[model samples]
Structure formats: structure tokens, C-alpha cells
Target: MSSHAPDQARVIPLRPVPTEPTEPTPKEPLWRDVVGDVLRRERLAQERTLKDVADSARISMPYLSELERGRKEASSEVLAAAAHALGLGLADLLALAHGRLAQPTRPARPLRSRIAPRPTETQSRPGDVRLAA
Candidate 1:
């Protein structure tokens, strides 16, 4: 029989352990994807057709379509031509892509300390080797 009363006895509730907030690995956006997305968005906002933009940019319609779908990486000259056709400069296009990349969907992680922790005694000594008898 317990001597302590129910009120006085210690009671530990079963609760989930609090853990560090884990963020899923963010996928790095490819340059082609960023460029294609910006180009598509700009074209759509202007209510322009693929053919019109391609023709004005002096590029093939198929190639422009591929670029818009992020299936093809465009050369700097092609990007410049497309940007010019859309009344934007290469810098403007790159800036738009940079902006998209800069926006974060999750909280930024804290930077880790540059200095590593000292090894514990359990860790093997440097250059120490043992052979079985």
C-alpha cells in the first residue's frame, strides 16, 4: 500500500518529446527553370502568343516553346533576344529569376558554428592502429 496520498504523489504525464523543427530539403531551382518560368509569366501577362514572341525574337517557335517548358537551356544571346522582344533587358530577366530564388517558403535555418567540437575520449586517437593477436 502506498503511504503518500494521490494528490501528493508525483505524476508524470506521457507527452511527446519536443524536437527541433525539421524543414524538408529545399530543391534548388535550375537556371533554365527560373528563366523559363519568368519568360512564360511575362509572355502570359502580355497576352502574347508563342509564335509572335518567337518570330519577334528571331528564334524558332519550337525552340521557344522548349525554352518556355524548361526543356532546353537557352544561350545568353537567345535569352537577350527574348528579353528584348518582351521589352526587357538581360539584367531585368536575370533580376526576376533572382527574386524568385530569393523568396523562401520556409524559415531560414540558423548558421552552424565554424569551429568543430572537441572529440570525446571515446573517439580513436589520431594515427593510432591496433592489430588483432
Candidate 2:
């Protein structure tokens, strides 16, 4: 009964406060892009064209070009064929990709992995079905 006036409610802000800027984080490269780089590098090193490699691999030039441009995700068979066409084994191709992934182009780590990482403690992931070979 002695108060001069009732307290008014303050408005809450919808936006969050800005923080200090930090170094930008690097993103993980896609598997297709990594593989495509290897393929293109090898082909160019050997002085070959897309049509030549595609012909030897028994795939359409457009398809091989797409693969080299990372526009498509090649199957195991197609990858093997392309590798063989380039005088490289499937293992060699994969090794090149692994090396590329291990290289550090930026200071920050990738948010997600582009390839299978080293073994870790078994943890169940959604839609993951382990198969014993």
C-alpha cells in the first residue's frame, strides 16, 4: 500500500549476444571428391584424356568425366575398372585417397569423417548393421 508504482516487465531479446571471432573450422572432404582428385591427377600425369581412360575402362566418357569431376559416386566395380585403366590397382587408388585425407589443408579439424576412421570402442549407431565376414 506504500509503493509508488508497480514494477514493469522487461522485454527479452530473441537474438543471442555476439562472441569474439575465432579461426574458421575446416570441413571434411567428401569421398567422391578425394577419389576424383586422385583419378584426375593420375590421368594427367600419364598424359591421358578422359575418353582414352574411359575407353580402356569400358565406361562412357561422360560417366568417367562425371566421376573425375566428383559429380557422381562410383561403385566398387566402376572404381576398380577406372583404377585398372589408369595402370593402378584398387588398393593403390585407395591409398592415394587415404593420404589425401590425412593431409592438413587447414588448422581446424573436420566436423565429420570422409572415410572410415581407425578402430575405436564398439558403439551402436543408428541404422548400423555389423556383418561378420
Candidate 3:
């Protein structure tokens, strides 16, 4: 009975085990992602149809849709045309993109804990100025 119990306790491995632990790679946002987000946000805020913008920009609806979805990398001229169609200059589009990139982000916390003041505020200097002259 003792020998049978010892044999039953031994388990056979069914799959190969990794010798080392693997680290997950962090994902970085692509330029297309940033630009697409800005464009989509602006379009939705203005309550304009994709077809209207595409016609105004002189680009095909499908192409414009692809661009807005970040599936295509548009040329400078195309981007300018699209910006113009949306009543925004190339500079304004780029500025909005830069602003999106400049936004501060933090790891998500529970709602209760998130209500607490941020650590940066406590450690910030009194005269710290963010604006450029």
C-alpha cells in the first residue's frame, strides 16, 4: 500500500517548460496613431461627415477614411490639403499633435485612491513656470 501511494504521488510532465522567464516588451505609440487620433477627434467635434471632408480635400473617400484610421502614411501635400479642408493649417495640426504627445499620463489607480492629490503637486517648486515668453 505504501509503495502504491508513493508511485501515485509521482506526476509525469506533459509539456516542455521554459528554462528562463521572459519579459514583456512595452508598446510605444506610433506617429500614425497620434495623428489619426487628432484628426478623428477634430472631425467628430465638428460633426462633419467623412465624405464632406474627403470631397473638400479632393481625396477619395476610401483614402481619407484610411488616413483617418491610421492605415495610410499621407504625404506632406496630402496632409496639408486635408488640414485645409478641416479649416486647420498644417502648423495647427502639428501643434495639436504635439499637445497630445505632451499630455501627462499616469498608471490607472482605483477611483477612491485616484481622488488624492498627485505627488508632483506636493514636490513642485512654488515659482515653476511652464509657459514660454
Candidate 4:
């Protein structure tokens, strides 16, 4: 009886399996820290320190530090001046701040007004009695 296996274990050329190149995953958007992070990065890129920007923006160093650290919320005026010091438009800064701040906007309640009751048919059409049809 012949065992019907490969006569010489049929030589099979083992090819190397191809592998896919891996890319780094993109970072998630930071909606909450966008404003502070943008400001800090831009300042650093422009080679300006917090103290320098604070002096130019006419704000306290501690307050500006807080703003850059995302620990403090700034008023519109302060934000405007800070943007100016950073050579950016007030509108741009405001847009960045708006993107970060959460607006508590709830839908308005429906309006309901009390209306006077209508008079009965007898009262409206005096002396008229109609038969049921």
C-alpha cells in the first residue's frame, strides 16, 4: 500500500507575507483647550514671553499666565488687547474664545395667553331656535 503523501514533500517556495505600513493616528481635537493652547503656542512661536505679552496687553502677568494655562476666562476687552499684542485681529481671538466657551442656551418656552370664552349660540343669535337635522 502506497501512502499518497507528496513523493518528496513537494517543495513549496514560502513567499514572505507583505505587511502594511503603519501611520501615526491623528490627535483628537481639543475643543475645551483650543483658545489657551493656541494663544500659548502663537506666543512661543513669536518668541514672546508671557511677561512681555502681558506688559504689551496692559494685563497682569499672573492673569495672562492663568489665561495661557486655560485656568482663567478673559473678558472681551482683555482678549482683544491680548490678540492685538500678539498681532492678531480681535475678531480672530474672539472666535477662538467662542469656540472654547460653552454657551448655556436653552430653547424658549412656548407662549400661552388666556382668551375670553365665546358666547353660546342662543346668546349670539337671539330669538332663533333651529330644529335638529
Among the numbered candidates, top TM-score falls to 1
- Steric clashes per prediction: 0, 0, 0, 0
Candidate 3's residue-wise lDDT over 72-131, tens digit each? 888888888888989999999999988987775645445544244433564544644344
Clashing pairs in 2: none
Best of the two (2, 3) by lDDT:
2
Ranking by TM-score: 1, 2, 3, 4
Point out where model 3 deviates above 4 Å: 1-26, 107-133
Candidate-wise lDDT, in order = 0.82, 0.82, 0.74, 0.67
Error of 3 at 28 (Å): 2.3
Which 10-residue window of candidate 4 scores lowest in summed lDDT? 9-18
TM-score between candidate 4 and the true structure: 0.48
Better of 3 and 4 by lDDT: 3
Tens digits of lDDT, candidate 2, 1-133? 3222335332323433324444555778999999999999999999999999999999999999999899999999999999999999999999999999999886654434333343344443344444433
What lDDT is obtained when candidate 1 is compared to the true structure?
0.82
| Per-residue C-alpha lDDT of model 4 across residues 1-133, encoded as one tens digit per residue | 3233534232222432223433454454454356777788779999998999999999998988888887877777887888999999888876766754544344333222222234455443443333433
Report lDDT (Cα) of residue 42, candidate 1: 100
Deviating ranges (above 4 Å) for candidate 2: 1-21, 107-133
Regarding TM-score, does 2 or 3 come out ahead?
2
